[model samples]
Target: MKTNPGQLSQLLKKSLAPVYLISGDEPLLVQECCDQVRKAAKEAGFHDRLTFHADHQLDWNAVADEFSAMSLFAEKRRIEIHLPTGKLGDGRAVLERVLQEPPEDIILLLISTRLDAAETRRKWYKELQGKGVHVPVWPVDADKFQGWLQQRASSRGLSLTRGALAIMSERLEGNLLAASQELDRLALLANGNTIDEETVEQAVQDSSRFSGFELVTELISGRAPHACKMISVLQQEGENPLGLLAVLSRDLNLLLELKSAGGQAENPASFLKKRGVFQPQRARAMEQAARRLNRAQLHEAVALCSQIDRATKGFDPLSPWHYLRDMSALLATRA
Candidate 1:
């Protein structure tokens, strides 16, 4: 059955499903679903567990092989597969055969990126949903993020002032894992679950220093020097290179999108609406980024970001910070 993340706990409480396809990009939500499944499986006497990560050139036959092997050892076994690439390919046929009559002692848990509508509508997928649970999670967007953070904080015994919560929300920027970790940190420091703006500022250094959004704005508005300076300042202030790079990549993606949408650049509001970007501030930033940079320059920015990505992964010889600083300058001035 198709289920939302909120319904997962209750669903698991009643009975464990034979097969589950939990898909989403949000790490916390996906992890939560998997945790619920794991807990339920363990409680239900499903001891033996096997895990697989699907990559290019993976032997699709391994699915059947592992399931069978796990079942041989344990009466109740679970097989978990991670397909971040979303390339089901020939594996779908294998999965279909495996799940044709969902095994009584085996539970198949498939984790993957968000499946598009077309993929979910496939015969094998529909049958899988029929036999088990299909849980999907969406990110806590900007509009609902603050409230979610507040609730999360409250659960952790941290009572943050509205101003403090706002600062935390912006600093973490909808990252649930980071938000959860920061809440733990705040709770440890909390005298009586109460936190003030200053305490928050101290907890997350540079909460007020330089924002990711401000960096985007400076770059998109063609303030090369300011963008470069902000990059340096933010870097020194302990901003995450990956997070900053993510924001910059988003900016380039938006610009590339606008460039592809011919004649839409003149009407920013309409374009933003068409693109489903609701946040007015972000919409404005994207529109401005699209307007300021041309197609070629935006592509160059994307290439620069790719280099930074490689550096972040230790694939490049240069420091990611160095690549980021160069990217900031390029976006601000040229690309």
Candidate 2:
């Protein structure tokens, strides 16, 4: 009745459940599970898909009416209810009524944001889980991310070295979408199916005039002019803003961590060594960035990165490049 993202594919192979309740905050993982269910449903001859957004403005009466009605397009239907806020609200009673005796002709797919423990205890969720399958997707955390990456790479028929994994885990951690994209790119460009650190670096370097790491270096080194130029170049080159943000986010987070760890008190090299920043040049650059920027500034820059992310995704009005330039100026500012 209950499963995880990894097991969903196997479960789908067994048989398609009448109901699939997928809840998660991680977009990629959640989408992957949803895709599996849709594919399986289609294969099982459930072709006509109807989607309803369970927002406050939604007419629950219409949703309920649609459930009871026969599909004019196809005999079997796949009904998807998307609950962005993870709350059914008025739809709670409607869902309960619909599921009381779900039509054999329809497959119900309920997708939502991460459901809190309280939400999990709700009658609708309990009923969905009991009746069919509930796949709760969780974010791949720092400790487990590398393992996830290795498995993903293997699935794509790519071999990754330890160093390659480390660099990837450093740059792509906490962002599965970017990680997946990078791996997909590697699958095409990789030579002889083997991906080492150099391969990864080359991939990043080839993307633009300045790679994400180089942009970070410019920002942290307080080279406002060069950093701004790099951002401009990256924008002109049509680089995905998300990729640039990924690298910036990682470095800003590390600087914040070092600041929190009392990194300023110890020798820069020693502190960096303890933190696994072995490269002398990178160590020196991070050390200087840490000293020049305060915790408050780093926090501001981090927040700005979030804004850039939203803008890039069309959630915000301004262009992502605007936020990118602003973030560069903020980080390039001396404490």
Which residue pairs show collisions in model 2? none
Error of 2 at 144 (Å): 1.2
lDDT of 1 at 194: 72
lDDT of each: 0.72, 0.78
Query: What does the lDDT come to for candidate 2?
Result: 0.78
The residue-by-residue lDDT of candidate 2 on 1-335, one tens digit each, is 89888788899998877889998756677778999999999988998888877655679999898888978765899989877555678888888877678888899999876654667778877777777898988767567889999999999999999999888888776567778888999999986578888989878434431366677777777888988888788788777776556556656767877887773567657766765566677778898898899989986886676567558768668999898888878877788
Please report the candidate that would top TM-score against the real structure: 1
lDDT of 1 by residue, 240-271 (tens): 66555555555566567677775644576776
For model 1, the stretches where C-alpha displacement exceeds 4 angstroms are 70-72, 207-335
Against the true structure, what is each candidate's TM-score?
0.70, 0.66
RMSD of 1: 5.7
Candidate 1 lDDT trough over 10 residues, lowest sum: 205-214
Per-residue lDDT for 131 in model 1?
A: 83
Among all candidates shown, the one with the greatest lDDT: 2
